[model samples]
Target: VYVETGTGELVPASLQRAQPALLEIPASLDAYLKSIGDKSRNMIRKARKLGYEFRRLTPEMLGQDIYEIRTSDPMRQGRPIP
Candidate 1:
């Protein structure tokens, strides 16, 4: 099991596991692109070349699109869809 706390606080001290990612998005896309490593940047470039454009999200506009995008693949990596 995993337990998380603030920087100094800890409960169970003996078990130290790798912490899960905490994403902190930059204010702009360019700033974000600059922050990631080269391999990730290359993937983004390839995605852009393949015409995968970024869409600004809105409650009514992107709900269906997001649903289709996420549910299109029933199995991703080695896990089954929830």
Candidate 2:
């Protein structure tokens, strides 16, 4: 199944524990929610109330958007704070 490393890397199902074997089908969202504590869930709710949306990013979309955002110089990128 899908597992996240401690450093926040999303390990694909192909790389999961197969020796002992997991019972359930791999799902990133399910594993992610289980990994976090209750406080995180509360924060997600609070952010959602302020017009935020949650989406799981694909590899291609992540490369274009999130990767670009992180690598870009904050001074050069003038996106308004929401």
The best candidate by lDDT is: 1
Q: Which candidate is the best by TM-score?
A: 1
lDDT of 2: 0.75
lDDT of 1: 0.83
TM-score (all chains, Cα) for each model: 0.42, 0.33
| lDDT, candidate 1, 1-82, per-residue tens | 4446877555664664788789897999899988999999999899999999987877778789878977999888879778
Q: Candidate 2 lDDT, tens digit per residue, 1-82?
A: 6779999998876753557755664478778778778999889889989989977877886677876776666554477433
Provide the RMSD of all predictions against the true structure, rounded to 1 decimal: 7.1, 12.6
Candidates in order have lDDT scores of: 0.83, 0.75
- The residue pairs that clash in candidate 2, if any, are none
Off by over 4 Å in 1: 1-22, 58-82
